[model samples]
Target: MFRTRSDKVSLVMGHVIVTRGIAELPAVFFTAIMEAVRRFDDFTEHNDPHGEHDFGALTVSGERIFWKIDYYKRGTEEGSPDPSNMVLTERVLTVMLAEEY
Candidate 1:
């Protein structure tokens, strides 16, 4: 599934308890999502407790998939800043199936 990283992906043949920014993906996926938004008229973002800032949920062949981002709020030092906002202190994108976790 990660064949389209545009050479940004890193492969690791090991395990860890936690990791950050270890995955790199292509921007084309986002383009496709924007296309889907224009075509399907689906809302692309949501707010929640788990830091899921910009959330993209799509259904394909009866399977639900998601694309989302986590961000840090600039001032109060809080997590889960909305990715659409221009003032995020940090941002990270994530892609996964609904049931993967």
Candidate 2:
């Protein structure tokens, strides 16, 4: 929702965070990684056993990367009591290199 639809994301207080390793990549590679993440849809039983579409792995420019979305309480560092309740939840999407896992 974050990559393709900003208006919807704003309703849930969505945020995107890139790790240090990913931030240091060249502009081309960084752009490629973001694009790859936006297009990622390779979920399977092995990687998505829980059926929560909040995590994914992909490769860009020969480098493996992972992205995950976590729910938190707005204006606090605690996890949200009800992620489904957009009124009280904030979504934080983190992107990082595989090695950083």
Candidate 3:
């Protein structure tokens, strides 16, 4: 399947939720996420080159943040499903606090 780009990310929080598009991703924040991903990939159990990202949690800027990507195994219908395609679609990243769902 062809890889799809993350056009934006949805943020889910305990009290409130928000969103941040790819264009709005702060460079510093993006850097932090990349660092974490790199570290995760280096771990013995996550060494698979074709591994797909599922969940991630880390502290950046003194804030504990968690993230998960929803892959659209099937295309979006009625604006539901975070990531909406057949087999693979745009992956929507859901970011939130550690305590939030």
Candidate 4:
């Protein structure tokens, strides 16, 4: 029913992880980054060739930021064999400052 695998990724969006670098940002800048991530929809062939919409980069308050969604076997560290199956996958979205990458 979803248009893409990304549409099915909502189940994992709740599991956000901000890296240490991002955690140290000022509250205003941090909030901006989070809001940007929520509103992001600039996918293109160059930035999202796979069309998974699992990764993105943006700038907030002049600071570069990067975010990525990774799929893993639910409750395990291994990569998921089928990322489309939400029941079998645990998606972790990690947000970090570009310099931290």
Off by over 4 Å in 2: 1-13
Q: What is candidate 4's TM-score against the reference?
A: 0.87
Please give, for residues 61-90, the per-residue lDDT of candidate 2 as tens digits.
Answer: 899999999889988999999977778988
* Clash count, candidate 3: 1
Clash totals for all models, in order? 0, 0, 1, 0
Whole-model Cα lDDT per candidate? 0.43, 0.85, 0.47, 0.82
Which runs of model 1 end up more than 4 angstroms from their true locations? 1-41, 44-53, 73-88
Rank list by lDDT: 2, 4, 3, 1
Candidate 4 local lDDT, 18-77, one digit each (tens)? 999899888988898989987788899999998888899998889899999888898999
Comparing 1 and 4 on TM-score, the stronger one? 4
lDDT of 1 at 84: 43
Tens digit of per-residue lDDT, candidate 1, span 49-93: 443324556764444556554455655548735634545544444
RMSD of 1: 11.8
Q: Which pairs clash (backbone N, Cα, C closer than 3 Å) in model 4? A: none
Per-candidate TM vs. native? 0.37, 0.86, 0.41, 0.87
